[model samples]
Target chain A: MISPELQAHLQSVIPSSSRAALRTSVLPALLTGVARVASTLRAAQHVSLAGTANAFGDDQLNVDVAAEKDIRAALAACGTVVTASSEEDPVEKPVVHQDGITKGESQETYTLAFDPLDGSSIIAPNWSVGAIFGVWDGESALHQDPKTRQVVSILGVFGPRTTAIVAVRTDDAPPACFEVGFGDQGKQTWELMRAHVQLSRPPFKARYFAPANLRSAGEDARYMALVTHYISERYNLRYSGGLVPDVAHALTKGHGVYVNPVTAGSRAKLRKLYELFPVALVVECAGGRAVDPATGEDLLARPLEEWDERAGLVCGTAEEVDLVKEKLLG
Target chain B: MISPELQAHLQSVIPSSSRAALRTSVLPALLTGVARVASTLRAAQHVSLAGTANAFGDDQLNVDVAAEKDIRAALAACGTVVTASSEEDPVEKPVVHQDGITKGESQETYTLAFDPLDGSSIIAPNWSVGAIFGVWDGESALHQDPKTRQVVSILGVFGPRTTAIVAVRTDDAPPACFEVGFGDQGKQTWELMRAHVQLSRPPFKARYFAPANLRSAGEDARYMALVTHYISERYNLRYSGGLVPDVAHALTKGHGVYVNPVTAGSRAKLRKLYELFPVALVVECAGGRAVDPATGEDLLARPLEEWDERAGLVCGTAEEVDLVKEKLLG
Candidate 1:
């Protein structure tokens, strides 16, 4: 549960721009809804109970449906949202506004696409996993199918005109802060944080925790244990077992690192990373950092017109993030 | 293919001592037989294709059979054999002179127990793997089975007086020399090796390759690639993909490092590191080193009686091994 002080801080940090309003007001609720749907999907598959479960197969479809519904509902709640389309249903058609919600006339517009889960296949072997996304404005859907989505356009969003954001969760402590970055500026932010923080110190051990599944409580527990053990042995770092949860936790914690390094073959496995940004500007104002590792630039700095081609991200205190960038991109 | 010069060098370098004769006359045949049996088992599984076979499973059984047959045959050929017992069929009672194949008057006696395929399960994942063995001068196998077999008084060989040798094979280069260590003078040998090698170079890269199966030729290729990449990138080092192959290669090459870090669970995983003396000896002999990271002591110097309870090993050119030992054990 989020402390009242932290919740207020989150609410106060939201930007006043049109993008920020939608992100601050509607993104969290949408993510919560998506999490619920994902949970339902896992329950249906009996993955949350005792028995061997194939983590892939139909569970993927369930995540897709849940992601679509959450994004649509969130968009509908924001009057400025003009016809939202996602990679899941890429017809450029307006989202079905359920609950009789109507969109208000506003120049502000955006499109979102995502992989609700990444590295899901590794769940059986208990490897790291997470979610990913790509977002843009003036476009309803980026690709015809989620399977065909490209990260190149996502990279485009890092250009001077665009804004991008990502939220992560794991099974550590909760009410975490989300990281935000824009263009090359993100790299500077990361470096600053690194210089200020002694990365090798205790409670700041370098650990990675990517949960493959988010819905099943049982799997969640296992994911938590894995993360806890890894962190406890090293630096006492914690995660929330979900992309948003983990990202949020990182933002609030002020130390540690979060990454979503998806190789080419694993793009479609997760989507939360892709969706949270367009609607969650609160992460930015909370003194956190996030950016795509490939460009060593901010995730939110690029315009929505070009956000499909970008690689995955690293989000944390500036210094730790810079270390990753140096290792991967530098 | 081994160059003629290298082959000649190997043949000449092998000691002419009774034990050296045993290794020269027995180890190669055992390795060859194990290879053949492994191939046959792979064929049985219909996994003989170039790229699709698993290398660790039932192939282990075949390797064991082949190794046992070759070792026994070699001992018998030397005319210093009375009876033999193997770890696999310990209850069969020592095979007495029969069918005129063996001279009943020959009082020479030796016993051998082997894990023909160590880390065999790593074959499926295309990782490094190998074989190990212990030789004793008695009639029975080292560890007895729970179920009583047809023969009872087969002369059990107990305690640390027995000599042990391990043969490792990896996919890097040809098999080199064996690591030889004696129970009484373990630490002395370790220190000599530590004084000779250079270990500190930055940008060090470490990789673990444990294949799940070993019978598939295709799996061998993958294992080879991993070994080559890791060694080349880290230290321009090369090792055989199997235990004997690796130990032999390291012994002669006189560079690089070999380590088996403790995994999350399962103490049984450390057996291969515990059993080999010559591998450590050769590593030290060639200006390299070997130590158990958990204990910070030279593995060869440690008493074998206490090895079953130890964790894992870290070995390399003396300097590198020492660095790891200092970080982990210190």
Candidate 2:
């Protein structure tokens, strides 16, 4: 059953000034792309062979590469998107129009930045993985700045129930949060499960994530001790080697912490534009906080000099994230 | 697509001597029940309310209790199952037939022991949880001896795809393994994906699971040290708070190890008949080993005297499990 409020969410992502015009635009195409990609990923169990190393130097499962192609095809066929940027592609790829408009000539309304298939390395284990995309309103033919320009951010988790969590920030309104159950195969059909949901405050249990082993080589002892401290405090370890599902888990539960810390001699693990920024916006929109451990500022406020620039992520319930900033990083 | 071999596996679980009779009888009903139950669980993301505590004293998600009812209703409709047993129920519940078979009058062919919603705790977090069942060929009514009297064991993982991993031992031949994509929702629609798959040997990278916090109080220092040693050795950690998916990962990857060890106060974490025996049968069928870490005996060989009898599980690649026995327990 697609929730009625989910359509409201899809509609809200567009600026109210252009609501009617954009209503039949990029959102429908984006949702279609996500659903198709999810449907394609369902075949991962049948395809077990690890294909090759991805652009990020992680082992790309055959399913991952296929999912990227499926999403790209779905998005391009939408005709509203001008260009697609992904961690899988070294350079931004132009989406061909069904009409005879060339890439350089056709006026497009939106540019998409996405991680077509997140956490490809863990596909073999059958762990939950997801696809994430952010949409920027096309003022220019291409959005020169991605981090500050995105009008909508989405995290899609293709787990037991395929879900799309959307954060829509129109210039007039504070960002709104909604979760839509996609993959049920209804065009423009979405049921909104929650509205104006925010992370729960203190006295809730905390769950956290650290992608790489803190005790692994070159990781600082102090960082390891901090994680050990979190463990000692009875924080549940919630890392699934997938950012989309982990963040979605936090969003739904309304509590728990998730972190990808920068270690000594290494930059932060997740890409700023493709992953961290979009998720940070969602977290912030939900009244939760995403912060950089180094400067102790909101991750959303940080400048992204490069699309691949990375940042340490500490995000979750307002209190838990506050606790992390105050007690550990302080 | 449901693998063709998977259908053969469902049929093969019935003893060849009575193959035709049994195939037309209870097994199809049972598979239908499992598939329906899995399909029901696919909606868990929408049904996020926490339910009453389960028999294990763990917090039960609403889906957990509902899943038990869904499976029970499906099985009862089949007319072949006499009684359904699960961790959720305080005692074995007799299946109520649509034709109104009284508890005493109806002669049932199979007694099922199951964890209807294994890893129920992980459901809220949207992590992979599973449905596990062991079928006992009924000579009498409800089978009192659970450990030894099982003819078939099936593990269903509800991840991106709803997969049923089956191991059928018909006395004369070695147990056979097959994976069926049951959620595709069509009868006799499964296509064969794999046959006689085996666990990879020592040179294969290892993934391990120990559900408890290694740094927690009452956990033995020796065990902690051993797990830390394994981590240093670069073994991937694969615990998702779900046994079926974790073990399924080992079977599919053809390598890795999973253990629910006996902590200081705890006897062992996993229940004998419900989880350990069914999984052990599947692992051993795949040429891996599932052992009682104490006496160095196979878990399937041990008698389960009580419904909640706990046993330490150490199962994976033969060489890797052997390493656990030699280096840690021994």
Candidate 3:
């Protein structure tokens, strides 16, 4: 788990430019901090494992529990959260102690529905996987039905002001830091990366890393190494293997590009994130970018949810993300 | 160019199995023979120190001219051809001699269209590529406009049949062979090749030589080396970049798999080949199998042209091709 001080530091870094000032608010920034910390912890655990089986159902539950606890604590500290509803808690199957010492009942204003480990199937094969969440204001209806409750939160969160972020944090830090540019600047960056390698002729080759089990530190390190190799501007090669942890490694390391191309089959999840300013704010704070490739517009500025929605995405950098969108939409 | 004797040797060595006899005929076999020779000659010319470029607009044109010349010469000698249409003269373009000599003109009865190079772009990127063709009976209604005339011969001979071939020639010759397994077998072959340094790994990967270019002794040698590295049972790798040249390479070497994933887009080409017996017959005679992955059915029964048709294909050894179909279709 990330220390509270570090979480506070992360919150402070939310970009203040633009209407993002809303995202920089104490509430959203705190949520972003909590989410980042959860991801970091999950990544550490995944790297310690050897194979993908280590990341199945129960394993996923454990990671989600840890993340939920951290997030809840963070929000509680701020006192902005009047009540919280989590997918992790069972509505009917309440916890009971043999000693008749029951734990506190569920209490929260906002509800959260999350898939803590999406694309987990790719773990054994070294593919990308990620965490996804939807948040809605506490007063939304459907808070009565357990099954329908998760859907309601997701639908409620689908609108402009919603944010999505994918981070690629790596263990290896380069000697010098660089920023990725958009549009023409982005193309120039690619050319520059290629040129630098061609001139130096470093014995570099593109590599892929996908950590399946974030509970294992060993697997996490391996995944981190792979991201480092891919994002090194000198090498100019990056890989996501289809998961958030793998992508996050690349973003945090500030090396290569990280992209998630929206597919026609998976737009529901993207729409759900547009209702809140948390995820997008955190990603931008980390010096990355997120958007829906189909529109080439700020994803947060669009409707949060639509039945005909196509796809949603987030990337480590704006340029890299845009390139992926161009390929898919073109 | 392969001598007439060598061509005869190749034709005689082809199997006469029931499956082989049912799928192809004399005309297509002769065309295949001509194609082999033309490809060899082109490869040889390219490799020679006195490199020369033919006036043809593309590799496809070059192959057409070479194949037509060989086929005409052979047919004239054997008195087997009553009439034929070369792709270069689809409308039987009048051959006019400008010299001060007596003028003569002849009309062609049979129409042919040939794509001597398919997936040619693969070569530049060091990927696989091949050739294609379609042949039909010339008895169809003729159009006054040359461009409007239906080239039945070319249209009839396109698709998967152009890709299959028998592994063995005659008792005295070696057999053509290819594998059926999926990525596992491919990876194993890749590993073996890399371990022996017989084939270089990617980043500075091996070059892709067009079959036409591979015909030259030097280019042929390099191509053979690559083929040997791939087809060795211990390696268990089959290479089928596309039709025509790829199949020809397998036919020449006596072994290699031909893979055509049943994608949603390739139905039209498959249907056209069903009209002509040449492409299908040649592959069967050469000792290979042709199969549709969707139904695990023999693909040589007929051609499929509908845009919505869906099926994958693998043409080579019966056992190997079947295995591939199972893996992909499943």
TM-score of chain A of each: 0.49, 0.85, 0.41
Better of 1 and 2 by lDDT: 2
Q: For residues B1-330, what per-residue lDDT tens digits would candidate 2 score against the true structure? A: 334565565555554655443455455555666666656665544665565787778776678778788777767655555667777774666677776643433343666777787876566555667888777766321324433467668787777766677776665556777666643433335444566657866666445544344434224655556665665565665556578877887777778777656666555678876788788878877788888876667877755556677777888878777776775567
Docking class of 2: acceptable
Per-prediction TM-score to the true structure, in the order listed: 0.35, 0.85, 0.28
DockQ of each: 0.01, 0.38, 0.01
The TM-score leader among the candidates is 2
The true-versus-predicted C-alpha distance at residue A13 of model 1, in Å, is 53
Best by lDDT: 2
Q: What tens-digit string does per-residue lDDT give for candidate 1 at B116-226? A: 444332232112234444434434433422011101110101001111223222222232333221111112111011122223333434322221111221223332333
TM-score for the first chain of model 2?
A: 0.85
After the best TM-score superposition of candidate 2, give how far the Cα of residue A233 lies from its true spot, in angstroms.
Answer: 1.7
For model 3 chain A, give the 10-residue run with minimal summed lDDT. Answer: A154-163
Instruction: Go through the candidates in order and give each one's C-alpha lDDT.
Output: 0.36, 0.66, 0.32
Residue A102 displacement (Å), model 3: 98
Please identify model 1 stretches exceeding 4 Å from their true place.
A1-330, B1-7, B15-24, B44-100, B103-110, B126-128, B134-254, B258-269, B272-274, B302-311
lDDT of 1 by residue, A92-165 (tens): 45545546555544555544454444323222211122334443444454422321221111111111011122
User: Alpha-carbon error at B5 in model 2, in Å?
Assistant: 4.0
